[model samples]
Target: ENKPITLLELPTSIASNTILTLLKLITYNVIFAK
Candidate 1:
C-alpha cells in the first residue's frame, strides 16, 4: 500500500536534498577559500 509511494518519492527527495547540501558546501568553500 504505502510501499509504492515511499519507493517513488523517497529517493528523489533525498537526492535533491543531497545535491542542495553539496552545492551549499561548494559555494561556502569558494567564498571563504584563501
Candidate 2:
C-alpha cells in the first residue's frame, strides 16, 4: 500500500535531505560567525 511505501522510502529520503540541509545550515553559520 501507499502508506507502507511512504513509510519505508520517504523517511530515507527525508532523513538524508534533512541531514544535508542541517549540514549546510551549520556550515553557513560557521562561515558567517567567523
Q: Quantify all predictions' global Cα lDDT against the true fold.
A: 0.89, 0.90
Worst lDDT 10-window in candidate 1: 1-10
> Residues 1-34, candidate 1, lDDT per residue (tens digit)?
4555577798998999999999999999999996
TM-score for all predictions? 0.77, 0.73
Question: Clash totals for all models, in order?
Answer: 0, 0
Give me the displacement of residue 13 in model 2, in angstroms: 0.3
Instruction: List ranges where model 2 is wrong by over 4 Å.
Output: 1-6
Candidate 1 overall Cα lDDT vs. reference?
0.89
Worst 10 residues of 2 by lDDT: 1-10
Task: Please list all clashing residue pairs in model 1, or write none if there are none.
Answer: none
Off by over 4 Å in 1: 1-5
